[model samples]
Target: MSAMAAPREHDGADEHLMELPSMRNPDPPPPPLPAAPPRRGLNFHPAVYVGFWITLSSATILFNKWILSTCEFAFPIFLTTWHLVFATAATQLLARTTDLLDGRHRVKMTGRIYLRAIMPIGLFFSLSLICSNKAYIYLSVAFIQMLKATTPVAVLVASWALSLSTPSLRTLGNVALIVVGVIIASWGEIALDATGVIYQVLGICFEATRLVMVQRLLSANEYKMDPLVSLYYFAPVCALINGAFFLVLEAGQISWVNDVMGKVGLPMLTLNACVAFALNVSVVFLIGRTSSLVLTLCGVLKDILLVVLSILIWQTEVTLLQFIGYSIALAGLVWYKLGPEKVLEHLVLLKQAAMEGRALGVVAVGVVTVLLVGVVWYAFSGPEGGGV
Candidate 1:
């Protein structure tokens, strides 16, 4: 009887344990994730070509300044207007020509797409171009470059604020390093010239936001659109907008146009226009190919080129301090470029999507982009224009 009673008691205890929530089942094993494929190596050889591309861009700025200094133009506004007009014409021509050659000219989208997508991108890009140009009018090339070095940081912040991407500690570290570098680079210069520093900072902020928006829009939708298509879409709109602005804001100032154009030979003027167009296109193409950090590093290299050119051509004086700051800025850029930090993860995500067969169309579109960009760049470059 005692043995039977003990057995019943043990069975009751087992039933009670089974009834409890914790005793239902042990923790299940985690689901296995698909293994990510190894990244293909980007040919370093392309970067050498990219270096030449960057030098061309840096030269455009100097040329813009030289034109402004030599001509009786309306400063920032005139410089920007000519840039917009030329870029618009160039992009439209090239975009149409490329489409014609490829036999892939899709009819321009009609209806709300223009209002919703096309105009906004164009206007914002124009705003970015104008703001940066305006800032350069006030700031030194070195100052603008140094401040613009913080672009990746600004982009990171913008992405996080928009909930497009999550903030990471590594990004924070890069941002910190960039801020330190900028402060050091600008310490003496800003002390000597506060207004220039202010404009430069404004340029950095605007340009950074512009970078974020470009990547976000490209990643989210319109991945199938050619990179040049954005230029075609944006350029004419920018020209129209600025054209309207010039009409309203500077109607009586039309004489400045001829005055500015008269300063350089027709060839140099044409070269300037071509350079501006090519630089803008190259920037858009590169942003699609790599992260913003990579593009900004390219910009830093452009700045370095500008500094050397400024010394040689403009006969600008540089002290030991400025040289040291320039070196430190370049070092920071190199470190950031080499480090495993990404300012625009969306670009990488797009590539991953392409790899996984999720976004094959996007990759297909970019396949011809590098080649087309090369052609445009070569066509636009010559000895007529020293820089800009």
Candidate 2:
């Protein structure tokens, strides 16, 4: 009996050891099979966004010029009012129909905010548009573009005066370079109009002030808005303000039945309005997809292209002195925005690349040198009336 009991006890101990092994290592459930990353939908490249913005902006400018100058509508205030009214209606339609203007919902806008913040900005916006459009009647597109290079300088001064930015000597110097360039360009302008220049200058001041005010509005966390939403809020007020100005200034002069409906047909005017509104939509995409640096650079490119287009389309005369001055202003504008550190870094990279015999750096330097030489030679030897 004792031997039988001993054998059974040995068997029981073996069974317990097998059970323990099974309980301790249960295979970890096959390690959870690793989740797949979510698939992303089609994303546009930054260049696409940049190109869209440039095309729309150029179209808007050219279209407005055509309507105001070539088409002989000549009434800037009326045209401006029409644009704002169309913008107001379009934004309202978009808000009702699409998710595009949903950003406006995020803004904590109250009546007080609208009265205090938006109305003032809209007033300046109206003034800016009126004056800018008026200037187009007198100024050529190339000269207008060159003059606009000073906008950043005006904005900087406005910011300082409004106490939004502290005064900086370095910044002042950078912007001063832009002023010098614009002055030189102005000097070289063959069809310079003092009246047009005054209008443009006033427009720049109003625009600068509006931008500063916009900065202040956006500083608050509650008031965050993209370009479209800002337009949605501001457009109505601007339209009303522009309408008032139109009634006061252009009501008697512009017989809408004759001037608008007869000369510029409804289809043409509607198309023009659509292009203008599309430009604002493009701004939404541009600002959303790109950095501020990209926007600044693209703006510079757009302005340059506009100058070229003006020459091709309208035979606008751009002199060598004007080119030199505009180039200087653009350089100053870039320097001001990018700062010394970034500029130095780029210069260092170029130096290193040239030293290493890279094709890109060497080619860039060569191209720039060729351009400078060509410009100098043309200025010295070209005919008095001949221009780029």
Candidate 3:
């Protein structure tokens, strides 16, 4: 009986070991020299093979100016009306195409989760657009672009306050660089009244705040519905809410429309509509692709390109200081890109790891990203006298 029991125990042990094969190591292969780690290389997408990003970004700025100059009505109102229309239409069309191609569920909105998910995002999206458009009115496109560079700083502050994320000293240094870049970019215009500076700062703060809120909202909740489905529903809601606001509270100021919208022709309307649509889509894609810091910096890039184009096309005056600031900002961008202790790569890696379910790695990468950003902010922060 003892021998039989022993045999059964051995059989059971073999079955258990077979079931947990992962715990065992396989036979070793022939010994060989260790392979070297792969070298890091700078790679660009196919579309960016010929500096497509630079080209598209430059084009975006030119389009902004063209749309603004072409439209007769107040910039924000016209932007709001057409942007929503185009976004709604575009997303709906895209959704139909996606469904037909993929044979997925046909854009169902029956879930309560869908409504809960989209409301905050849709609202913030519209608010951010409105704030940015309004800021353009109060500030020079250059000044606004300069101040908008502080978006990274805003996001860091929000993260620290909310305990959502912690940023490193390097990141903080980059934020400082951004502020300096903005100030240097606008140094020529610094002679303007203090009120103008205040407005620019406020605009920057608002845009930054909006960005943080957007990131937070997007990250917190997950809806079962498709992204296009949500976008399709959210668009009309945003348009309706913003349209109502424009009508009720801002309607009194609508008298300016006739002066600006004098004989709105089809061609002009089509052009403005296209501009507004492109702006929204580009911004959305930019935010999706990179950090808000990157988005803001991209704005700086766009502004520089626009300045050059504006000078060439319109012969606009760009003072020497403005040129210096642009140079400094571009240099800072290069610095951030090359520095080993930068947050950009770490942040990208962390984001990828999070998406891939490597939680432990995410923690390490996120910490590194934050530290790099903080360092960047500190290095680029204001000078000893507190001036950018």
Candidate 4:
């Protein structure tokens, strides 16, 4: 009996040992929640995703400006069409050859879901890009940036109308400040182009609709927040739609040999497309992991940085009124993000600390925020060699 019991015990021990590795994941732990201190550098955090989106988006604008204005490409529709083509190729290649997009559903291009959900989004997307690129022909970068500030307002209102978001009055009021700043900036615009304004507003409406559609199509719990996957699905549809537009509007009139793209600019345009594709990936990531409100805030912050960059790189003229209006807008954006309750909560905490002695959390959070912002600014502000 003792020998039999010993054998059974040993068998149980062997079974337990065999299951040990299977019991736990071997992969690294995921990045923590936003409430936790943010870890930087290509991690799966919302901050990192938003940072990627901002960097690529900023690069896209600067690159497109160079291609259009400096290089005199004279082919906005072709350029956008090429971006979609490149994105589709790159995403498809990655999906086929790598495990990066492995678990993504591997969704096919020809499904009822595709026609009903994605096709409409792609049509609007095509229109938005076309209008956006066309606007650049009429508007200065500074003016465009000013108009772009109204994106948050457009997004929120569209979201509310579509039942995509339920923002509080405080949020609406905060976004209103953005609108006010934008109006002030527009009022200050030196060369007001009515056509450009029309194009921009139309593009904004289409874009706002697209964003809401994205949430409706993809805001599911089971979906993995992989930007690559989203790109794989959306890229082909957008490419086909843009391709049709390009063929109709641009194919006959384009001067292939005289155009910048034909004369040693292919590589440059390809590189620009690569960056644009990366921006799409970052967009999907940010949208998947964060809210539209957060995405709106991210856009506002990026516009601020772009305004500064427009001053530095493009040598765009800036007025005192424009500068002051933008500053007020930035302040409003910050206040809106923090909200009255959060601001009051922080103030109460600080007050209590003044009266008593508990203040570590507030102090720590402030220090961390300051340090992170400093690091990011130093990194992206580029080399500081010359000054005014």
Highest TM-score: which candidate?
2
- Candidate 2 ranges beyond 4 A from true positions: 1-42, 350-388
What is the per-residue lDDT of model 2 for residues 40-77, given as tens digits with 9 covering 90 to 100?
45257867867886777788788888888898888988
lDDT computed for candidate 4: 0.58
TM-score of 4: 0.71
Q: What is the lDDT of residue 302 in candidate 1?
A: 53
Q: How many residue pairs clash in each candidate?
A: 2, 0, 30, 0
The collision pairs in model 2 are none
Q: Could you give me the TM-score of model 3 versus the true structure?
A: 0.59
lDDT of 4 by residue, 1-388 (tens): 0001111111000110000000010011121112122224445866777677677777787777777766767677788788777877887787788665663663443478778977887787777777777777777666687775565466567667776556567567767787787777677666688998998888777766665565555444333224456556666787799888888988998876778547427678778887776665544344435643455445555666666666567556655556556656655554555555665776687678756755765664575467445433442453642121
TM-score of each: 0.65, 0.82, 0.59, 0.71
Q: What pairs collide in candidate 4?
A: none
lDDT string for model 3 (70-153, tens) is 342445654565557766777667657643112125334455744665565556555655555554444444445445445445
CA lDDT, every model vs. true structure: 0.49, 0.70, 0.44, 0.58
Between candidates 2 and 4, the TM-score winner: 2
Candidate 1 lDDT, 1-388, residue by residue in tens:
0001111111000110000000000001011111112224533454543554565566577767666544434455545666667766766576566532121144246557667766765565555555565555455555566566665566567667766566677657655666676666666453245665665556555544544444444443222233345555555776787666667766666553365455555577677777766654443323324433444445454565565555556444444455456556556554554454443464576668877777564654464355334323332352322221
lDDT of 1 at 340: 44
Q: Is candidate 1 or candidate 2 better by lDDT?
A: 2
